[model samples]
Target: MMIQRYNVDQQGVGQFDGGKITEQKPIGFPGEGSEVKRVGPLFYWAWAKAEHEGYIPLHPHQGFEIITYVISGKAEHGDSLGTRSIVGPGGLQVMQTGSGVSHEEGFVGSDMQGFQIWFEPHLREALRRKPTYQQFEHEEFHQIDFHDGVHVKEILGDDSPVALETDVHMWDIHINHPFIYHQQIGKGRSVSILVLEGRGRINETSYEAKEFFVIEANELEEMNIQAEAETRLIVIEVPTTVNYPLYRK
Candidate 1:
């Protein structure tokens, strides 16, 4: 299997919320000063941090499933749909902009940290549907405690509050002790590993914080993750086929 690593510093950087929010974007669009967009079917992966309470103005999106996971502090979300809510640490917000939608965001407290991930579906089918939103607290998720030092938390899975029209599986893993985790990717499936904290080895390559490793289905077998510290990571598994055509404006 081929393993590619992307360090945190290699990601594109942007400041928002009057410079209160600093973002590190992986898989950003090419060229300078351009809004980061998806390559292939994946839209974007952004890690944002707020120095203090702040807000991002209204913005429009379509034909994509947007997911936000809070790591720390609180995040307040409001949209044109008249939905307003606050998501604190370990909370999740999923917005499936099947056709189109507009939304705004704000941060609370001295430090706010979170991740915003975008996934795309078949464009033609997506535009035919209406947008929807779903929210889940950390307590609603499935948490597996391996008292032996391994824990697996299902953030989005087969039996989760967040649902997607496409075939995708996402999880957050926390390991406090030494252990090996395995995942089998079927044929034509793609797997991406993003390390949020600590260090780990994937296929013999060491990956540190903010590093992403994308493994192609045809190039690999199962995946093995080993932690060198109390590690936290987000994994996304999806099919390799281009089931959707992205619309860029």
Candidate 2:
């Protein structure tokens, strides 16, 4: 078993609207100074926060699966595909830019926070399809609670409402007490974990708020996440290797 950790400062930074919005990127683009540029198919992951509000004008994207997960407040998404929607807390907005698409987004409410993640698919196959957009409301996802003060909300998986061509699974987890959470990791796979709130330890390694860790496929069968306090987190599980050629930056 092997593990690597990155603190908030170790990640890249970006801002918009005169710094009204700031971002901590764990898997950013080249020259972005992020520790992990691309974890298999996972390309970019940005944890963005809005002090009062912020906006990003229409931008073009191609052959990338972009997702925005709302954490605290709401986000307004407007795209050229005639898709206009507002996703609130626990909601998700996915944009599969096949051939191409132009879209703009903004954060609303005080202290609005969310994550913008990009996943790359097989470029040739993705570009052969049409551009699309999908939005899942806060009530659209399913949640499961265990006996242990732990809860797992399915964001993307076999049973999740959101579907994509990318082979990935995502979840939002929470635990309110000292507990050990275990799971069987797939062979030749990896999991990207981001500590959104509170503190915890993976095995014996301590991790706090806004930390990012990548657990790779290195003979680790089970992962034990031990929480010492009320902790909340997000996890993205993907293959350890991509079958297609990735973008070079």
Candidate 3:
């Protein structure tokens, strides 16, 4: 087992709309200073917040799969495809920038919070496909409650409604005080975690809100975690190695 940790300040930072929207990036673009650049097919992960309101001007992307997941308020999206939509809390805005696409985003309501995650597929194949956009409401996802203060929501995986060409799995987890959570990780895979709220311990290491970590297992393994208080986390699992070529930035 290999474990790596990065505290808030150790991660990359960015802002849009003159700081109205700020981001703490666990995995950021090159030169942004995040300790971890890209994790397998998972390229970028930005946890963003709007203190009051903010907007990101139209930007172009190509050959990347992007998902905007709303955590608190709502996010309004406008794209070159002439699509206009709003995804509220617990919803998702997905975009597969196949050939190319230009999109703008706006944060609505007080203290809006969300994540913009990017996943990569084979660039040549991706660039040949047509760009597409879709939205999923909170109720559309599959969620399970253990009745022991642990709730698991599937964001992307075998049973999830949202599908992508990338080999990845994602979950949003919440655990209450004194409850333990366990996950099995297979060989040749890595698990990336970002603690969104509360305190917890992964194995023997303690962590708090805004902390980022990764666990890579060379063999089959199980992770034991305990929440010292109410805790919320977004977890992503991806292959440790891919046969396809990755972008060099």
Candidate 4:
């Protein structure tokens, strides 16, 4: 078992639209100065917020699966596929830029918060497929409330409608103070956890908001996380390696 931690100060920072939009990248592109770059198929992850209102001009993407998950407020998307859509809080906008596609983004409302994450598939196969776009409301996902003061919302995993070529599992979790959340990691897999709110402890080590943790196991392992205070986290699990060739930075 291996666990790596990255504090907020150690993450990468970025801005857009003259700083109208600010971002904290847990995993950024190469040379972005993030402690962690690509992890398995998980390429990039940015937690962004609109100070006021912001817009990102159309940009092209190819051979990657992009997901925009709105944490609060609203996000509008316009793509070269002639798709224009808006998703409110707890909604998601997914773009499979299989071959190639251009898209523009707009953040509506003050202090709008969201996450834009990129996942890589087999590039050669992805580049040969057609691009597509899809959207999902928050209620469409499977949410479970555990008796132990833990709530989990499945984003991309079992019982989720969102589908991509990448083999990954994602969840939005909230744990009440003094509660514990346990997770099992299968062999040859890794789990990345990002604290979005509150504080927590893992094996006597404390963690707070904006912190990222990566845990990998060569053999099946179990992890126990206890919430020091009310805490919210996003966790993604993926294979440690793939059979196909990976893009090197």
Indicate which candidate wins on lDDT.
3
Please, what are the lDDT tens digits per residue for candidate 3 over residues 156-216?
Answer: 9998999899999999998976788999999999999999999979988899999999999
Query: What is the Cα-based TM-score of model 3?
Result: 0.98
After superposition, candidate 4 runs with Cα above 4 Å error: none
* Ranked by lDDT, top first: 3, 4, 2, 1
Worst lDDT run of 10 residues, candidate 1, spans 31-40
How high is each candidate's TM-score?
A: 0.91, 0.97, 0.98, 0.97
Q: Compose the digit string of candidate 1's lDDT tens values, residues 125-244.
A: 888999988888999998888767777878776867777876678888888866777877777777777788888787688988888777776754888887777788888877766655
Q: Residues 1-249, candidate 4: write the lDDT tens digits.
A: 888999988788998999999999999977676989978999899999996789999999999999999988899999999999999988999999988999999987778999999998999999999999999999999999998788999999878999989999999998886887888999999999999998878656688999998888899998788898999999999999989888776
Clashes of each: 0, 0, 0, 0
Each candidate's lDDT (Cα)? Answer: 0.78, 0.90, 0.93, 0.91
Better of 1 and 4 by lDDT: 4
Which pairs of residues collide in candidate 1?
none
Candidate 4: residue 235 Cα off by (Å): 0.3
Better of 1 and 2 by TM-score: 2
Residue 207, candidate 2: alpha-carbon lDDT: 86
